[model samples]
Target: MSAERQLTVLSREWCHLCHDLIEALKPLQAEFGFGLQVVDVDADEALEARWNELVPVLLEGEVEICHHFLDEGAVRAHFQRIG
Candidate 1:
């Protein structure tokens, strides 16, 4: 198997949905073995502008896997495809 990759979550501290998504992804991380990174959109001007309304965006590289919520099926499929 290839080494695990990093998954990015575009988020802000105040977003409960964002936090929920992160919590949901934890089990997926354990199963698929990928690193999770949570980025605060408010910390960067462009990221804030681009993703302000789209908090809880999940990405593998530049490809957005899910947004607003954690799609467990899609996440499994993505890892399966990449695996």
Candidate 2:
């Protein structure tokens, strides 16, 4: 992992997709040791406003990995390229 590279999953409360993502990514984080930050959009007003409709967004620094849907293949590919 790059010293400065980290993964953040933006999500919100009562989001089943977010739950699914957390379930799906547990292994990846465990395997590759990617720093994962799951932020609940609803927890903060600013986050809620910015990402209220963009929940489940994956971010590597300022670059977006994907959004709404979790594409495991794409995510793995991104990690490989960025790792």
Candidate 3:
């Protein structure tokens, strides 16, 4: 799969929800064989501004998938669509 097919998680190191989302995505990443990129939103000014309160945002390229939680159904649907 291409990089665009990977899931990007915008998060902050101090956010518990961010950690939880990453943990939740582990099995899905394995099952779907998709790459998962975790980025600290606080590391970038723009990202931090846009996603500060919405840390743990899941994205497929520029498309927002979910925030503060892992939406398994949406994730599975994304895989289905990509495949």
Candidate 4:
């Protein structure tokens, strides 16, 4: 698979729902064989500042799908488009 196929997830420490988001993505991750990076927004001051309120955001490269929750259909469509 190409590097762009990887998935980036922006999350924050102390966020309870981040786990939910990750769990929701399990199937897609396995199917696409995409690397999942959970970026702690708190670690980057700027990112934390910008996306603090938008935790649990899913991204494929720079393409953002849903924030605050996993939209399975939307995410699946995104992966299909990418593939």
Candidate 5:
């Protein structure tokens, strides 16, 4: 993976789904060697307002890869595309 490629998880500390998604990404992150960042939407009022309903959103830069769950296929495809 290129150092420039990163995946961001918009998460909430209290959300089980958010935790699940982050855990799910760990193996993929190790395999793909992409940077992972987890952000709490609740930390920012604007972020919370915009993504209140989508706590476990996955993003590559500003582009959303998936929401509410981890899509491993989409993530793999993204890596392939970038390569």
Candidate 6:
């Protein structure tokens, strides 16, 4: 298959929800063949301001799939649509 598509997670240190979301997405990444990128929002002022409250935001090429929690259904739908 082609190189996996990039999926982004906007998160910060000490965020359990962010960690949970990543853990949940690991299996989906394997099934759908996408790569995960974790960004520490606190590291960037703009990113921190924009996503501080929405720290576990899941994005597929800038289109948000879900936030704060792992919306598995929405993620699956996004992958299927891209496919």
Top TM-score: which candidate number? Answer: 6
Candidate 1: 10-residue stretch with minimal lDDT: 1-10
lDDT of 2: 0.80
TM-score for each of the candidates: 0.91, 0.79, 0.89, 0.86, 0.91, 0.92
**Evaluation by TM-score, superior candidate among 2 and 6:** 6
TM-score of 6: 0.92
Model 2's C-alpha root-mean-square deviation from the true structure amounts to 2.1
Clashing pairs in 4: none
lDDT at position 34, candidate 2: 78
Could you give candidate 1's per-residue lDDT for residues 1-83 as a string of tens digits?
A: 23369999999888999999999998888877889889999899999888778778999998889899999998988888887
RMSD of each: 1.4, 2.1, 1.8, 1.7, 1.1, 1.2
Q: Where does the lowest 10-residue lDDT sum fall in candidate 5?
A: 1-10
Candidate 5 regions with alpha-carbon error over 4 angstroms = none
Which portions of model 6 show Cα errors greater than 4 Å? none
Residue 73 shift from truth in candidate 1, angstroms = 0.9
- TM-score of model 1 (CA atoms): 0.91
Tens-place lDDT per residue, model 5, 15-82, is 99999999999999889888989999989999899889977999887888888999999988888887
**Cα deviation of 55 in candidate 1 (Å)?**
1.1
User: Who is ahead in lDDT, 3 or 5?
Assistant: 5
lDDT of each: 0.88, 0.80, 0.86, 0.82, 0.89, 0.87
The per-residue C-alpha lDDT of model 3 at residue 15 equals: 90
Ranking by TM-score: 6, 5, 1, 3, 4, 2
Candidate 3 lDDT by residue in tens digits, 15-52: 99899999999888778777889999888999988888
Q: Arrange candidates by lDDT, highest first: which order? A: 5, 1, 6, 3, 4, 2
Instruction: List candidate 2 segments past 4 Å from native.
Output: 2-5
Least well predicted 10-residue stretch by lDDT in candidate 2: 1-10
How do the residues 1-83 of candidate 4 rate in per-residue lDDT, one tens digit apiece? 45446788898767878889998889877776778889998889988887778898988767788899989899878867866
Q: Candidate 4: lDDT of 82? A: 65
Better of 1 and 2 by lDDT: 1
